[model samples]
Target: MIQDVLVLGSGSAGLIAAVSLKIKIPRLNVRIVRDPALGVIGVGEGTTPNFVGHLFDYLRISRRHFYELAEPTWKLGIRFEWGPRGRFDYTFSPQMDLQWGDLPRPNGYFCDDEFSNVDLPAALMREGKAFARQANGAPDIQPWHAFHMENEKLVSTLEKVAMEAGVEIVDGKVTGAERAEAGIAAVMLEDGRRLEADFFVDASGFRSELLGKALEEPFDSFGKTLFCDRAVVGGWERGEEPILPYTTAQTMDAGWCWQIEHERHINRGYVYCSELTSDDEAVEEFRRKNPKVPESPRVVKFRSGCYRRMWVDNVVAIGNSGGFVEPLEATALMVVCGHTRTMVDFLLQTELEPTPSMIALYNEQASKNWHEIRDFLGLHYQLNTVEQTPFWKRCREETDLSGIQDLLEFYRENGPTGFCRYRMPSNLSDFGVEGYLVMLVGNKAPHNKPHRVTPEEKAIWERHRTANIAKAKQGIDVKESLYYVRHPGWQWNDEIQAKRG
Candidate 1:
């Protein structure tokens, strides 16, 4: 029987895993060991629609409280600046019934019937609106909303929740682990303290302290495909234009830049390949681009890849320690949260037999999920038409990759890159048809189709799209909606305090 678990790290993954386990089995002894020396990547703030039920409900984290502590502004969706030139907003759509089935196309292109109301968010934004608007009196659509939090806020919030739930939080670095023939027998901290547990979770970011050191699973690099390994991040106060309810991911010559909103200041970053651009150059270019609302940003470096095995023997790695893809799409948190949720489910529900077969299945599932996310992130680079610098050109022509060729070919014909679309079961259920359309059609990727459709179906789709757009527009006043949330009295800005109350 599993009596105790030692979670090694304090990032989202480590905290989430601990909370999930505590919520599942209250009596299980769960402890989080965090080292003050190791810094969190601290850049993953954007989230997907999955935050609603998967993360909030599972962690027993109050959604409203989370928003308040994180000083979170609602994220309708991401605005991608493709080719370093054009911008397109992929927002939450309202259209219904998008499924994976044989669809018909008129021009030998695989045409999915799931393209309705995909532009609703963009259209609303064009008219100055927030997608997930929470007003006092009016009935809200409650569309997909995720938080744009200071990563530190998220960690602190989760730490409080996990601690209150009876999980121990220890501040110390793990120096070594004594291993037996079975697996790790006990972990020794830098203070010369020994802690023994039945299971160990390696959430120690890229270091992979417990797993990497004990299991010795070599890390597999994605340097060949992903060029950007370093990032410089900083914050700026909301300017006179008012805080935008959406996150902007602007493509640059070497990499991409992200603009996220917090309560006091807007968090911004320029992610680029260190091999291509120096830190000083990136800083100068950022200053030149934005002359207003200025603050110096800090630089952080990283490798884009994961350990060959996320879990081996008695230990399982999560977050950056397990693997990391580019933050082009702000997928860092989504991947980590998704994996931790799955891991929790496995631990709570499935009995730990310690059999070779059981371990193999767990490893296989984790590896497949991680690789799928990596390939999907790689798609943003591989399918680009940008040739601005050696980075973009190399991305467009980068070979020696695996897994995504099928997805790319299918998209070239079917419309939409099907990269890592099947990782989570809830993705399809929550997103619906409009969601798929935004990714497939908005990105200018379609499939070769031969399914013939009658004029009746075509007319029906057009009519539905027009009607949905009209209704979404009428639901709320765009400018007024933004004003409503930005109001300080709304009490959504104090993320930490909200949770305590």
Candidate 2:
């Protein structure tokens, strides 16, 4: 009977794990240990719709209260400045996957010449709108949109939520672990105190103290697929800039730069390969691009990979302790939510005694999740034709497309067909076929079989796009949406909250 669970570390991962367990299974004892000396890698973070669902739907956190605490801006999607065109928007909504009622082909087929205004969210992104306006002049908030938040505010909010959920918060630095036959028996703290639990969760970030150090779990690196290792991150206060509804991913000489927007700040990071560009060179390039930055940006180094198995013996690894790609898609929190949710589900399904098969299944799914993300990110580099720099030249020549070779082959032979979904893994990523098609078609990756549309079809597509553009223009900005939500008389719709289990 796994009654007590101890989570190591106090970042977003550890707090999320502790709170989730405590909330889902109130009978179980959940405690999280933190080293007060450690600080979070505070960079602006963007989230997918999955993170929103996990927080509001699964965790049952009050939306109104969350807004008051975690001051986040709305994100429609990402605006990529890569590929041949100036830019293209990839929204959370299903743009390329679904076909219009009158059209015979999927939306991707019509996006070859012009990629914008394919869906409402994409149009909203282009128009700098966060949400559609309702009849009463309120923001029509939907489930498909995401958020852009500062790391400190997000972590602080999670800590408060965890404390409220009956999770014990202990401040201690782990010195050593006592080895049991199957797993860790207890962890020794710096204060000369020992703590034990029936199960252990490693959320110790890249250190991976429990799973990687003590257990000596073998790591599978994604170096062949993801080459950019270091990121130079910095930000500036928002002065007169309009709060854009989408994150901007711009191409750089060595790698790429990401612009994550907050209500009052704009955070940027240049992710580059050290082999092609030195730290000084990268900083120079970053500063040349954005001169608004006041101070010298700090560099953060990381490897891209996951362990052989997330669950081993009685311990499971979550968040960066398990694996990490780059922040290209802002998948850090999304992955954390997924891992924690899966762990809680397994515990409940097995009635606290997880069988060997259950553990095996958990590890299998975890590996698939990491690999799918790796493959998806690989497509971005493999298909990008934006820059001809030494780094991009090497990427085009050597980037591994083995995992997504079949998908690419099918796409080249037949342009963005819905049938391509059959070629993907059974447990497809959140990106799904929509994401692949968006990247492929958006980048102008040539397909042999091009769909030549007739004049009538072209006119119909134009009409649809114009309608979307009109709606997007009528939508409200994040500032206006915030005003409505923060209003004293405003009420949140309970449709999503009502469906929570």
Candidate 3:
């Protein structure tokens, strides 16, 4: 049985793994090693509902405490400033995929001319609202909403949680790994100290020390599908900004830029291909677009790929050590939470003695998750209508859609029908059919079949949209919602908390 687990690196991924393992299985010993010299890549990060569930429900962390420390802003969805329509909202809640009781078909069919305000969340996104206002003037929070967090605050909160959960912290820089037949027997520290564990977790960011370097796991690159690699990251403090409730993904000459909103800051990063545009050129373009940034932004390089197997023998790789796609969908932390939860589940089910078959299954699931994300992100590039630039032209012409060809074909013929869900893979991503429909329909992708809505059905859809628009108009902004939640006399709804947990 695995009694002790040593995690290398103290980034968000490492700390999450340590805290999860220690909290879920109190009998096991979890220790995380870190080098004080290595600082985290502090930037703004956006998350999906999966992360919220993992933090508050699966791990049962106190929401109030997390809010106090992390100070995350709520994100209803993403506002994409791309494609033919100029922009569209992709909310966490289902809008296009939904079929109202009074409507004849799914909402996507009627969204040909006007796509906004299809649902409450999308409406809220359009109006720059975080949540709908209740009768008593409090924010009526829903499960579909997510968070936009500053990485430094999030890491510090996770470290605190890890320590409180009895996870030991060891300060050391790993120099080498002592290889064993099963996996790594021990890791050598720079100070000549050796650390041993029954199991190991590698969360060493892009370095991938344990799984990639030490174990020599083969990497499967997504170069064909994902081209943009370098990101110029910088931001500025907020002054009169309204603290918008969604991340903005705007199209650029070479690639795209993300605007992650924070309470007191607005973080921006331009992700572009180094080959297409030089670092200096990209920086110029970024500054031209966002002049509020006072200083030069630093360029961070990365590759898009995944290891052959996340779980090889006794060492399980999590986060960037396992794989990483771009932050187009803001899935880094979501992936971390998922990997940690799965590892904990496997250990618990097997009583800390996971069989070879169980490890194989885990690796299979991990690989599938990576591929699904790659395919979904590929769809974003494949269907984007911004075909003016050379880089975008290449993306539209050459992006690999082999994995999602069937889904695309169906949507092209059937126009975002819910039936496409039946044709999807058994292990579909968390995005589900709704995500694909939103991307396709939002981009106004061409379709052979078009639904001709009758007068009655059109009227019904109009009524629904109008109601959502009214409610969203009356909704609370992030600043207002924060005031209510942070008030000393205010209390979170017990029923909602119980449901989430």
Give lDDT: candidate 1, residue 244: 62
- lDDT per residue for candidate 3 within 1-501, as digits (tens), equals 999999999998999899999989999999999887987877538999998888888888888889999999999999999898889999999987789998778889998998899899999998989999999999999999899999989989999999989999999999999999889999999999999999999998899999999999999999999999999999999999899999999999999999999999999999999989999999999999999876688999999999999999999888888999999999888888888888999999999999999999988888888898998898898888666899999889999989888888888888889888876654536888898899999899999878889999889999999999999999999999999999987776653667798
C-alpha lDDT of candidate 3 relative to the true structure: 0.90
lDDT of 1 by residue, 1-501 (tens): 778899988888898878877887777799999776776667788877676456555665665555455555666677777632355666654322243233333211223433324346655544445553334544253645666678888888778778878999989988888996766878999889999999888888877887777778898887877778888777676655555657888777678888886656777788898888898888777666665435577888898877887778788888888888777666667767677766766765566444566667667776766565565556666656755688777777873346656444554554433332442222312343344444445455545643455676566556645655665566455345545655665543235575687
Candidate lDDT (C-alpha), each: 0.66, 0.89, 0.90
Q: Which of 1 and 2 is ahead in lDDT?
A: 2
- Distance from true position, residue 267, model 2, in Å? 0.5
Q: Which residues of candidate 2, in runs, are more than 4 Å off?
A: 495-501
**Model 1 spans > 4 angstroms off:** 37-39, 92-119, 132-143, 292-296, 352-354, 399-401, 414-440, 446-501
Sort all candidates by lDDT, best to worst.
Answer: 3, 2, 1
Position 206, candidate 1: lDDT: 76
